[model samples]
Target: MYSISIITVGMNHLAYLKSLLHSLYIENHPKCSFEMIYIDNCSKDDSVKFIRENYPEVKIIENKQPLGFGENNNKGVFASTGKYIAIINPDIVIQKDSLDILLDYAEQHLQAGIIVPQLLNPDHSIQYSVRGFISIKTLTARILSKGKDNVNNKTVNEYLCKDLDFQKTQFVDWAIGAAFFMHRDTFAKLGGFDLDYFLYMEDEDMCLRCWKNNMPVIYCPQSTMIHNHLRGSSKLGKKAWLHIQSIITFFRKHGIKIKNSKEHTMSL
Candidate 1:
């Protein structure tokens, strides 16, 4: 039996955080085989105090200085002592037996470096959480239709091969960072998420690194979790700015030059 460490980065989401902790407590997993770490990234609310009083079992890392997603998660990663590390968001709730399926998949597929479970919206609708590569066109389309509706919904299914008859686990270019699981050794090999990305696109950067190492990022629909993804860089104003900055940084760091609706410079 392999031990697992669950890491979550949160700030000011006390209500959702409590629900998340409670879900974990009732989740049908062997408690002796896993541990949870919450990194409070200088939250202005009473999240720290709340965790301290209620969830004493969770090891809380109080960040005196504010840290971004990648940095704060890295803090939790360093503190974890599990063979596999699960990067989860505070708003996601793992369904009963979800961890069992994920662990079983990981054990069966040794070549797969990173794994993502099927992500569902709050209403139990199938959310295409996996993605292909990113380009300027994708970025621009997403920017053009920011708050009104999901631009990705139009092309996400085809991109993720959801339209095909393939229902089994398959390799993917990238998986959303909302909920990701990978071996501790693989995380060390890839150096974890790049700290340069303050918030968005860190998952893409990490996926690119895993691809370079000839490791596959897999999507297993057998195991599913409801991801309340209405947080962070998806909000109205500041989220857009952070997203654009991260896009530009992602291209520059990966040497991908945008052309006519295509970024052909990147190898994978």
Candidate 2:
């Protein structure tokens, strides 16, 4: 069996997908033995053809109908034969030793629910991928802070985990779904992502479940990757509507609790 299974879903992300695939394969970024799985979400572009032609070794799961992020990842996990599985984005470029670092940490902290590396922008600035468990109050304050520059963005800052030191490795509430790692057993135990979240908020729900189950969410700064973040939630119509719907579903499943990140921290 492979040491790690890297899964990524793409919908017309041909350019980004090429960079990611090249970095993983041609550059041989991962140190451990791995199986690559790419889920094509009914792309209108020639993404499937390119993968089949350029990287035949990569297992491709093509969909007739577009699927959600969580569903695509679950499908990849179902097809994987690795001890560890990473559900990442097509826009992320992996480092040679990134997976090995996370694997070493996972070996030591076997109970970790989700482990994520530091995500950097193209210019090498840190992305706010790590965050505390988002509460309704924090969400409301973030919306309110959009227009006012002088307003204290403390609530939003805390929600993004800016209150904590970003340089040090620590247990956090959650990380973005762009790059999430977990053992196959842990994923099976958690039942994977909740189907209730069709688009967004699935990552947060999974991490919240992890915390509820006393499993730590590890943030390893030493393992860094570059992510070309496409902020779909910031879009005007459909994406925004989906985000709102997911938020409602999340709150329905688990009530809007306003606990801090310190409360969720484990002995790790």
Query: What lDDT would each prediction earn against the true structure?
Result: 0.77, 0.85
TM-score of 2: 0.95
TM-score of candidate 1 against the unseen true structure: 0.87
Local accuracy of candidate 2 as per-residue lDDT tens digits, 39-77: 899998899999999999999999989888899899999
lDDT at 212, model 1: 73
Q: Residue 265 lDDT in model 1? A: 30
Q: Candidate 2: lDDT over CA atoms?
A: 0.85
Q: Relative to the unseen true structure, what is the C-alpha lDDT of residue 209 in candidate 1, on a scale of 0 to 100? A: 82
Clashing pairs in 2: none
- Give the poorly placed runs of model 1, Cα more than 4 Å off: 30-32, 147-166, 257-268
Most TM-score-accurate candidate: 2
* Native-structure RMSD, model 2: 2.0
Model 2 stretches with alpha carbons more than 4 Å out: 146-152, 258-261
Query: Against the hidden reference, what TM-scores do the models get?
Result: 0.87, 0.95
